[model samples]
Target: MHTTTPTVIITGASSGIGLAIAETFLAQGYNVVGNARNAARLEQTLAALNCGERFLAVAGDIAEPNTARQLVTHAVQRFGRIDVLVNNAGVFIAKPFIEYDQGDIAQLIATNLMGTVNASQAVAAQMIKQGSGRIVNVTASIALQPLQRVPSAIPILIKGGLNQLTRALALELAPHNIQVNAVAPGLIDTPMHTPETHEFLCGLQPAGRIGRPQEIADAVLHLSQAGFTSGAILPVDGGMSSGVW
Candidate 1:
């Protein structure tokens, strides 16, 4: 019988939704390995959580395939098996398509696209060997429903691909008993958003308020345990994707 607890690797885990997800999993007794580009910061924050030996911080550039390999290697070495991989690392930039610069485009592709791809590839191999696992992505709801005021085609373009990747990977990995899913969120009240923008952000959602990081964390937790569910993009978007507000 399997005696050890499940292990989860959460990318971009130093802050925002990623941090919340880490906290949630830790609270539930899952061994957590968190990744981020900032090593000191990642260690400082998560280590302070007093998770003892159960929490590990592997700091590296999320955009690199090496980083994803490092995460998988560390998780397997420390925890013995990988059960969940949360591709929660991403960058969202909003501006007119024409206004986007090369740097912006490159960063978006690196953080939002390649990070997920690399992490998924590395983790899937391990999970397939183990015969079971879960992969949950944190994509954006804006990819589905566009906002004229927020002409962020570049971010949507990459995030849109993730939504598709969720389905594609789910189909490809089903026989291995590995489920792939995504949580597409609307405006969330993270450190990414300043306090002054909260009121304005509230109006953008049918719920009349931005979502909390913990809310997204909750959605991810659900996907992590949902064995019968796959290829599903669960929108925790406060009705933004529901219809016209």
Candidate 2:
């Protein structure tokens, strides 16, 4: 570890892609602040990772603006400054557009779109004051390419919104030396999907298999270090965005 290690704040860090990203950064000797709604789950995550003093867990629902504020505040208080932020907290429910009720719409907006906006707003303010920062948002490939089999139009609305906001914020924050980007992943092999459905999901990606959480983690790490890259929506979806595999 360097004498002055940089710090990262990752949302939804208790499991799946978020958990992998947190582990990756911690392994690279960066101070990590992991946030999730379940405090006990966050504690278990911290214990499992065993990053010692370099990792801190902040538990909260990022859909709330106050949670975002508290995440930034706690990170700075513990690590002095936040160098990177990964807005990976989101929800997805696949169903026919007509089947999605108002509650589903509201939940998707809260967790996916507003969560990204709220967290980015808080982190950007701190980054602007520091004069440099990296923000990597976790979106879905469905944002760019719709899947006939998925029938997830309602959820796509929120993730697609994130893609647009990534470019907008990137341009707006470029002058301040902050890079804003997003990663659009395809069907990833997380706990969200059961093993019985893995083979079916695999066929959804052109790569002929589901992606690993570590793969998305690697993409986020790359964008963070890619100084000249901003506003770029890098799709790690194994050709899902490409027509006919």
Candidate 3:
């Protein structure tokens, strides 16, 4: 490990792609701050890594603007600086648009879109003060190509908004030397996916396999270090974006 390790703050680190990315960064010798709504689950997940003093868990609802700011503040207080921000906290609702209640739609937008916005804003301000940082937003492949089987409402709207935000923020933050980019992952074998859904998504990909969480984490790591790469959306979806099937 280097004498000085880069510090990263990952939202939704309790499970799925967020948890995998946190583990990967820790393995690479980075000081990691894992943020999630469930304190017990966050503690359990962090304990499993055996990362010792290199990791911290901040428990709160990131969908709230104030909590998002507090999450960044906690990381800064612990690590002195945040070198990377992974806006990976999101909620997915698969019901048809018409079937969605107003509250359900609001919740989906709050967790998926507003969460990213709030976290990015809070962390980017600190990064600007430090004069450099990286922001990686995780989006879904369904945002690129809408699928009928997968209810086209939430993911399509929320992830598309995220992609747009990625580009806009990249341009705005470029002058500060803060790189902003997004990763679009498809059908990763995470707890979020059911066995039947995973198999169906795998069959749609030309690679004939569902992606692993680590695969998406690798892409996140790449974006984190690729200072020259900004406003780009790299798809780690086993060629699902190419429609190679």
Candidate 4:
């Protein structure tokens, strides 16, 4: 590892695409601070990764601004400074719009929308102080190109806003030498998708198969290092953002 390699804070890093991002960054020798709501799960994840001192698991709800602030403090205190933040914490509720109850709507907003906002807002301030950083959000490609078979209006409504926000944040932070980008992924093979739904989920996209979490992780890593690439929402979903299937 270099003497001053990047230190990254990856929210929702206990599983799925977030986990992959954590592992990818650690493997590349970046100091990683992984956050999740469940403390026990985060401990298990830290133990399982066996990444030694390079990885730090900080448990917290990304939806809460206090948690976001704590994550930044832990990362900075442990690694000296923060270089990248992956706002990968989110929740997806897939059902008919009318079927969504108050709880469902609230959960979706708190996790998917507010979670990103909280983390990004807190991290952006730190980055501004440091004079450089990268913010990569894990959005959804299906939000831009909704599947008729999957009617998740509220979730899409939240993610679509994130897509636009990525652009807006990129422009806002560009002068500070901070890049904000996003990777909009399609259906991926993760614990989030059970085995039974794999086949059906595959058919929703033109890829004819599910994407791997590593693909999304790779996209995030690219954006983290791509100095000139800001505000661009790269689609990692196999043609899902192209058009209607």
Candidate 5:
């Protein structure tokens, strides 16, 4: 059915875990369509990856439905079809539950929850026609098991929603032969966390270390190629979701 190379669309691909995933896919010779708010940064990443023409960077806010549509459209137009969709675009803010305002709640819902929903809808429509596809969503470990050290109820709520969506979509799309899964990371060493904060964040994980971007990327890649695996929520965190140590 597919005459061209398999194509993957990765959101939040400007940096960190998303960027690492993009690079890994590109290295594997898959056509990568990366989306993010910064077109310049996406372009820079594309250049750094050095996978000319195999990579396309689409820049826009994932919170907007239009961006999701554009990403799917671009992937279809450039490549033959969408084989994989990585819903990695998200915003993380940790604070006391009561400290969150209406704006904070709205943003968390828009970017983390709604963004994945919109992108999944667009990609699933295309995948259904093709009769096969894979979706890997990136969520936070706090969504599975809360950490007393980090009181982030608002954002975790959004991530937790994605975890549920992964299972639901996997079943709903199973008949269509589409697979859906999620990867939850804990205290990943990304730009979001400062060097000074690493020491504190590492203590939360039982492994006593923060995860690398490639670690998450590797888990995503594993799920992408795992034919029999779906409705799975893989925790790439360093045993943070197991229990408090």
Candidate 6:
């Protein structure tokens, strides 16, 4: 099967790593549907891509269960089918676990963990119908080593759960011929992290630098093309996973 001209759905596609991944797939001549909460930003980003008829921008909160189904529905309606799904919509807040309120905890889980589940479930259904597909999840290095204290307990909880979800779904989906994988990214220069925070994180890495969104996007692209790979966690962390302190 020639999956080269596949249709991809990427959540959190307004900026950062998600945006980069969308752009990468667009560049590869794949039809792409970008989902984000910010309609204005999504429009601007897609307009800049100049993808002509190869792209569609859908505005919705992936954290909501219905929104994931809507996103997949619109993508399939616009294009024909969905071949790749990138669960990239997530948030990170720094705070002590004790300082977190119920709402904060709920939001983190909804956006990071539940959002991934919803999107993956919806997309996986389509993939199974089609007989083959790929899913690439974006996770954080904090999930690997829980020692790094981000001020917030939410990010840790959400990311940790996300990692577990990734592994579980990979196993369940493999039998359906749908490969599921995740990329554990170290600190990257995105709007989520401030300059000071980036510098601090960079110093903690063996590379002495923070990673780029494009770097992570590159890994996503590779995973999408690797047919025989599944249930894999590829870390594009500038060696941050190698213990950088």
Off by over 4 Å in 3: 1-3
Which residue pairs overlap in candidate 5's backbone? none
Please give the TM-score that candidate 1 achieves against the real structure. Answer: 0.98
Which segments of model 5 are wrong by more than 4 Å?
1-3
- Residue pairs of candidate 6 with colliding backbone atoms: 94-151, 94-152, 95-151, 95-152, 96-151
Residues 1-245, candidate 4, lDDT per residue (tens digit)?
A: 32387899999999999999999999898999999999999999999999888888889888888999999888888888899999998888889888999999999999999999999999999999989999999999987788888899999999999999999999999999999999999999989889999988888778899999999999999999996899898999989889986
Clashes of each: 0, 0, 0, 0, 0, 5
Candidate lDDT (C-alpha), each: 0.93, 0.92, 0.88, 0.91, 0.91, 0.85
For candidate 4, list the clashing residue pairs, or say none: none
* lDDT for predicted candidate 2 compared with the true structure: 0.92
lDDT of 1 by residue, 1-245 (tens): 12299999999999999999999999999999999999888988776788988888999987999999999888888889999999999888899899999999999999999999999999999999999999999999999898887799999989999999999999999999999999999999898999998888898899988999999999999999986999999999999987666
The sequence of per-residue lDDT tens digits that candidate 5 reaches over residues 1-245 is 23489899999998999999998998887999999988888888988888878888999988888999999888888887999999999989888998999998998999898889989999999999999999999998889999887999988878998999999999999999999999998889999999999888887778989999999999999999998999999998999899878
Give a tens-digit lDDT track for model 3, residues 1-245: 22357999999998989989999999888999899999999999988989987898989898899988887778877778899999999877787878988888888888888889899999999999999999999998888877666776766888998999999999999999999999999878988888878677777777899999999999999999995899999988877777534
User: Which portions of model 1 miss their true places by more than 4 Å?
Assistant: 1-3
**Estimated TM-score per prediction?**
0.98, 0.97, 0.95, 0.97, 0.97, 0.94
Best by lDDT: 1
Better of 2 and 3 by TM-score: 2
Which residue pairs in model 2 clash with each other?
none
Candidate number with the higher lDDT (3 or 6): 3
Task: For candidate 1, list the clashing residue pairs, or say none.
Answer: none
